[model samples]
Target: MSFETIRQVKKFTMTSDERLFALINATRYILDKKIDGSFVECGVWKGGSMMSVAYTLVERQVTKRQLYLFDTFDGMSEPTDKDYDIFGSLAKKLLQKNKKQEKSSIWCYSPLEEVQQNLSQTKYPTENIIYVQGKVEETIPETLPNKIALLRLDTDWYESTKHELVHLFPKLVQGGVLIIDDYGHWQGCRKAVDEYFEQNNISILLNRIDYTGRIGIKV
Candidate 1:
């Protein structure tokens, strides 16, 4: 996967290069192990990581699982009371650029159409991919995949992360992988993860995929 193709993702995607590499590596492992169940991503900004998942599946001609891309496409929601401590402080410290609060608040509110275009233009199997556009708290309740093989959580707020973990973790299949993109990158997200796992008594070995990326394979 020299990705003579990485350039395309890098050129247009918003995530850091290291993060992209980590996502691809993790996606490849799912394919290599032939993990059963569908693929899912809670934060699909620009669809970069999601694109890699599509590309890898196509490259391997994997047609059994559908890829679910969930996002508001509108960017990050207002930091919840629980999230205010961290994200609120950060937002207050930084000057909002373009007078856009989403950019400075916690994460970006991306456009659904643009991301759809990126994946469509890249020739991903649009037919098998599902897009859920709305706030995670509202949009995640119904129609979630019955089983998830690789669950990627990228939302940067504690409330958002907490909701995803609460709703999706139970559905994650045994031997499936859970990747947290903000474990080391964002304080609110890290706290939510740590608290949730500890409270739930989930003791899966947490491994660092990179500086900001982490993974836990369900046993």
Candidate 2:
């Protein structure tokens, strides 16, 4: 996809242009290789990234793979001490704010309805699009496809990120790609991914997508 075309995909997502380009290219690679599985995204804030996947499918006229979107639609779930930014301030503030009052994170409070509408407006096949609304820790195992062609995770917390990799990563087929949106930017996200690899004794080259994003092809 051209950078101009990817810019259009960026409209519905908060992801940087380079990350979106990576996502688009990954989708294209999956299709070109005829990987057998569906596309999955763990955090669908505004549904932009997944929309890009859908857009690519439409542009390529490949209509069989399903797109699974999972999120807490209301906003971010409480971040544990393990979940913190690189400087370790953002998560602490969020933790403090949680204690003072029950409030969702303002940054990711995109509602399910709004996200649905954003994606539906794309005119992608409605039946092929599935939205699982809840914390990924709870919803992923129950709702994720049995097979996945591409798994893009942006949940940016320790427990949630770890939970996703444990459950979903195994389902990603050979030659499929695993994209971690916050692997480099968020400490907790990075920790979870590294620990998952260590615990499983798996080693794969993670291609850099800017400073914060990473793409690992499942060998």
Candidate 3:
């Protein structure tokens, strides 16, 4: 599905226009440069962003690179105090926007079965997509590709995000793109990423795709 078609189809969870642009551009970079690696998503909820990558790859006929989906499939691990803080604020805003949402939690709550169902709904071929069902700390380390062309992460909490960066970032090929989906919006996510860079003394520039998303090109 093209971007315009994706816009028209709103059944999937929310992904901002700017975020999609980053995905498309990163996909273009990998395909055009013939980046030798696969695409991976550390946290996929209902397969929205994951399918977006699959759609673009299929559209461009970039079939060699597989797309990996990593998640616990059951909500998140236990939320810490910081996670509670973020969830509390987000819940209030969500309740104000849609009273119906007050009934239950949103994201990461989707089970592995549902994620597979969601992927089956997309036009993209699933043959090149790999689904690893488990927590980031476990699945990411064990399932990392030999090289990563595009690594997009949306894992909401601190531990999960940091685990992903620790295990997978090094596998990112030089010139590969690493996109962080909840960078500016979620404190836990931001702290994990910022701390990783700081601890490593990594100087890769973070280029903003939008208020909520940022990308760094591995060099």
Best by TM-score: 2
Residue 13 in candidate 1 has what lDDT?
58
Q: Is candidate 1 or candidate 3 better by TM-score?
A: 1
Sorted by lDDT, highest first, which candidate order results? 2, 1, 3
- How well does each candidate superpose onto the true structure, as a TM-score? 0.88, 0.92, 0.85
TM-score of 2: 0.92
In candidate 2, stretches whose alpha carbon ends up further than 4 angstroms from where it belongs are 94-106
- Greater-lDDT candidate between 1 and 3: 1
lDDT of 2: 0.85
List clash counts for every candidate, in order: 4, 0, 0
lDDT tens digits, residues 28-52, model 1? 7888887788889998877878887
The sequence of per-residue lDDT tens digits that candidate 2 reaches over residues 1-219 is: 557666766666778888998888999999899898999999888898998888888889877779999998877777787877766667757655653322234357787888889888667888999989998878868887889999999988989999999999999999999999998878999999999999999999999999889998999
Give the per-residue Cα lDDT of candidate 3 at 213.
90
Q: Give the Å error, residue 111, model 1.
A: 1.6
lDDT of each residue in 3-48, candidate 3, tens digit only = 6636632355566877876787788878889888989998776777
Model 2, position 47, has a per-residue lDDT of 90
Q: Worst 10-residue stretch by lDDT in candidate 1?
A: 92-101
Candidate 3: Cα lDDT at 9: 29
